[model samples]
Each structure stands twice: as C-alpha cells, then as structure tokens.
Target: MRRKIYTKEQILRAAYEVVATEGFAGFTARNIAKRMGISTQPIYLEFKNMEDLKNELLDLIFSKLKNEIFPVPHTGDKVIDLGLNYINFAKQHHNLYLALYVDEEGGGKKMHDFSFNYFSTLIENDPQYEGLSREQIQTLHTGTWVVVTGLASLASSGSINPTQEQIISLIQRTINNIIAVNETVN
Candidate 1:
C-alpha cells in the first residue's frame, strides 16, 4: 500500500490555520500534521524545513496585506479609509492578526516595512496629498499606522474596549491631526 502524498499547498493551508488559531507556539510540524490528518513526513518532503514553511507563511501574509488590505476601495479618504480597513481586518481576524503581528518577535519588522512602502505609494498617488513633501508624507503614514495598529491591538486584546464607530472616530481624529500638523510645518 502507498501512503498518500500531501502537496505544499495543503501543508501551507493547514499550517496557516494552525498558526491563526494557536499562534506561533503551536506552529510546528506536529501541529500542522495533526490538522492535516497526516504525519510530519509530508511536510518534510514538501519543504526543506520548518523555517522554509514559516517564510512562505510570512510571504503569504505580506501578499494579503498589499493586494487585499492596502488597496481596499477608497471611501472618500484614501489614507483614513486604508487605515480603517487595517483596523477592521484586525478586528475581523483577531487570531490571525495576533499570530502574524504579536506572536513572533522578529516578524513585525518585515510587515512594518512593507506597510510603510505601501502607505507611501498610496499617499503619493492621492491628489489631496500633493501639497505634502516626501518627508511629510512618510511622517503622516507613520502617525496613522501607529494609531490604527495600536487601536487594533487594544481592541483585539480587549484591554480598551471600543466600538467600531468609536475606533473610526479615533482614527479620523488622528488622521486629521496628522495632516493639520504637517500643513503647519510646511
């Protein structure tokens, strides 16, 4: 009798689910194998090692962040809308958000850099941001990202419980302040 072979996609899908639910601590060969109803051998066969699989997962997260989350339809305000979308994504995918951002120590830097680049591009393309210099645009992105990410973290942890409307209000206020300050500086 031949043992069924699992493809890389199958292993990654199971790994993603495990990481989403149980976070990095549970992201092991055994955990993924258990979720897939198979042995660890399939994972080993499909990848060089666990680190490779983890890199692939990180890439997947980055891809989602860029293609799906960042480019979300404009809602009259590109920066604020994108910021809101980020927080909303966190609110919707708490486990996934935590696992990707909070579970691992070194993982966030890559995501942060990716977000910075994406936000810079978004703002540069907006006519409303035309008056702002490159430095101001970068600063604005930093401020908005920090606020929304903090809000998402707190909301996900249930530390400072805020309604979605309240979160949006806070984000709006923050974005307004950022722009106002930048305008004054310029």
Candidate 2:
C-alpha cells in the first residue's frame, strides 16, 4: 500500500476544521491528524510547528472573512450588512468565533485592527459620512464596533438569541444614537 501524501493546503484545511469545530482548546496536531485520518507527520512536514500552522490558519481564516464572508452584499446597507455578517458568523461558528475573538492570545488584536480599518473605509465612501471628519469617523467606527462586537459576543456565547429584526433594530438604533450624540457634541 502506498502512503497518502497531503499538500499544505489540505493540511491547513484540516487544521481549520479542527479549530472551527473544537476551538483553540482542541486545536492540536493530534486532533487535526485525527480529523484528516492521517498521522501527524504530514502536518509537521508541511509546517515547522503547531504555532506556524496556527499563524497560517489565522491568515487563511482572515482571508476567508475579507474575501468570501464579509464581502457579500446584503440588505443594501454596508454597515448593516457588515453587522449582520459578523453576528451570523458568530452564531454559526461559535467555537471559531470564540477562538478568534474571545481568546486574548488568539490574535484578536490583529482581527480588531483589520475590522476597524475595513469599517473606516466603508464610512469614508458612505454618503451619510461625507461631512464627518476623520476623527468623527473614527468615533463612529469605534461606536459601531462596540455595538457589533457586543452582539457577536453574545451570539457566540448563546447568551441572547435575538431574531434578525431585533438585531437589525438594535444595531440601527445604536448607530443612530451615536450619530446624534456625535453631531450634538460637535
């Protein structure tokens, strides 16, 4: 019988599956190998170590979010769509969400920076944001981030299972209030 050889992509995908379903606590080479029905040799051969594989996995997941997940237009409102996508992702992939956002050492800072920049860019192009200064836009981004991240964290933890309408209303109202306050302040 010939040995089964796995490419780096295949190994990385298997690792994703492990992390997605089991979270970082179970994110181990042994678990990944078991999920792939292969020995750990293939994983080690493709990557230098578990940390190396983890960094690559983080990049792959971020690429998926930036390219595949968050880019999809929904509800015709960029901010609404972004918030919904984030909440849905947390709801659907609770373990992965917790792993990526909840764990302090899980590169949450990188994810935060990426998300803030992405949100800021969206605001820059939005007509509603046209008159807002960069500082105000940053404030809006921070406010929106608080609302969205709070909802996502709750969703990931199963603390609040709100309907789509409730989630949308909450996000919209919070954003409106923030804008009102920002306008009043300046």
Candidate 3:
C-alpha cells in the first residue's frame, strides 16, 4: 500500500477546520488526519509538529481577517467603523474569532500586534482624534482593543447577551468616552 501525500496548505486548512469547529484543545494530528480522511503521517510530513501546524493556521486566520477588515476607508468615521467591523467579524465567525482573539494560548502575540497596528493606523489618521498625543493615541488604541476583545469574549461566552447593534453601539460609546477623557486630560 502507498501512503498519500498532503500539502502543507491542505494540512493547515484541515487544522483550521478542526480548531474552528472543535476548539484548540481538539486540534491534534489524529483529529486533523481523521477530518481529512487520512493518516497522521501526512500531517507530520507537512508540518514539523503540531505547533508548526498551529502557527501556520494562525497565520492563515489572521491573514483572512486582515483582508476582510483592512484596506477599506471608513467613510463614516474610521474609529467607529473599525469597532463595528471588529464586532461584526466576531459575530460572523464566532469560533474563528474566538480562536484568533479570545483563545489565550492560540491567540499569540502576532495576533495582538496585528490587531494593535490595525487600530493604531485608524486612530492616527482619523480627524476626530487628530489632537491626541502619542501616548493618548496609544492608550486609545490599546483600550479599544481591550474593549472590543472583551466584548467579543463576553458575548461569545454568553456572559453578555446584547444584540449585534447594541454591542457595536456599546463599543462606539466606549471609544467616545475614552476620547473625551483624553481630551479633558490633555
């Protein structure tokens, strides 16, 4: 009998499906192989180890998110649009978003940096926040990330039961509050 060969992309895609559907804990060579209807050896051939596969999958996940959220000018207002898009992505791909952002272990520093940079760019260019200092802008960026990630975590985990509109509104209000405080302090 001959063994079937699987490409790295195929293994990573299978791993994504496994993680998205079954959570990070369910991501294993055996499980991914089973999902792909092949033996575990194919996965090993494609990845050095499970961690390698996870790293690749994380990259893929973040790439998709970046494509989906970035590169569009927020005509209404950059900050508000960014927050709305963040919440909308969370709701639409609850499991993937959880894996990418909420799952502590899987959601590594790269994901964090990607998110920070994404919002930081929005804050830097938005006319509404033009007067914010570097430190104030940094604070706003970090605070928004925390609020949005926290909101997604809470909503996904059933800790907060707000509708999508309500969640987006809350995030917008929080960002506004942060800006107001920054304005008074500056």
Candidate 4:
C-alpha cells in the first residue's frame, strides 16, 4: 500500500477526536492513529513529538471553544448571555467541558484564568454594572465566576437541566446579591 500522507491538521483533528470521545487520558499517538486508521508514523512526521502535538491540540481546542462556544444569540443583555453561553457550552460539549473543568490535568487553572479575564472584560462594559468601581467589578466578577462555574459543573455532570430562563434568573439574582453585599460592605 502506498504510504498515506496525513497533514498536521488531520493528525491534530484525530487527536481531538480521541480526547473528545475518551477524555485527555485517551489522547495518545496510538489512539489518534487508530481514529484516523493510519500508522503512528504520520503523526510523528507531522508533529515534533507528543508534547508538541498536545500543546497544538490545546491551542486548537481553545480556539475552537473560544470561537464556537463563546458567541451566544443576543438576549439583548450581554451579561446574562455570558452565563447562558457557559451552561450551553457545558451541555453541548459535555466531555470536553468536564475534561477541561473537572479533570486537573485538563488545564483547569488555565481555563479558569482565561474565563475570568474574558468575562470580566465584558462585565466591566455592561451598563448594568456601570457605577461599580473597578474593585467592585472585580469582586462581582469573582462571585459571578463561582456561580457560573457551579452551574457549568452541574450541567456537565448531568445533574441539572436548567432552562434558559431559569439560568438567566439565577445569574441575575447572583449578580444582584453580590453587588448588594459589596455595596453594603463598603
């Protein structure tokens, strides 16, 4: 048989499939080759090593998630949409979400930092949070992060099937409570 030449992208995609289906524990050259029905030689040829492949895979996953998962249909309210989008992502990409958030080796801290910085920027811009100082906004961001993370964890674990409306209400309430407590404390 002629040698089947696979592009780096193809190998990376196969690696992604391995992770998506079996979690990060299954992310290996052997499994990637099996998924693509090719020999591990192709993967080795396309990437420097498994670590390089893993780093590239992580970049691809982050890009895919940032692009595909972060954009929510406008609810005319961006802050509420942030919480909704997070839950939706967990529901849609159960294995990937759990692997990233539930499994330590999946780079949970990286995800958390990325999430906080990203959502905090949006929260800073929302008119609803306009009068809050930067410190207050950061406090609110931390609180919102906790709420969103908990909801996402529950969703990923299949423990909760919350409607969009219900999630929106809960998020709104959480934000309000955090702001109220922050204001009271100050």
How well is each residue in 1-26 modelled by candidate 1, as lDDT tens digits? 99687888899899889878888888
Local distance difference test, each candidate = 0.81, 0.84, 0.76, 0.79
On residues 1-186, what C-alpha lDDT tens digit does candidate 3 reach at each position?
A: 995668888888888898888778788999999999998998887788888888788778777766766544443767656766776677767887777776776677878787777767767777877767878878887877788777767766677777756766776788788878887887
Per-residue error (Å), model 4, residue 107: 2.2
- Across 1-186, the per-residue lDDT of candidate 4 in tens digits comes to 896679998998888888777888887889999999888998888889987998888778777766777756658666677778877878878887777767766856777777767767776777876778778878877887788879988977888878778888888898889888988988
Worst 10-residue lDDT window, candidate 4:
65-74
Candidate 4 achieves a global lDDT of 0.79
> Candidate 1 at residue 155, lDDT?
74
State the TM-score for model 1.
0.86
**RMSD from true fold, candidate 1:** 2.2
Model 2, runs deviating above 4 Å: 1-3
lDDT score, candidate 2, position 55? 88
- The best candidate by lDDT is 2
TM-score of 4: 0.85
What is the C-alpha lDDT profile of model 2 across 74-95, one tens digit per residue? 7777788889999889888888
Clashing pairs in 4: none
Against the true structure, candidate 3 has what lDDT?
0.76
Candidate 2, residue 30: the lDDT equals 96
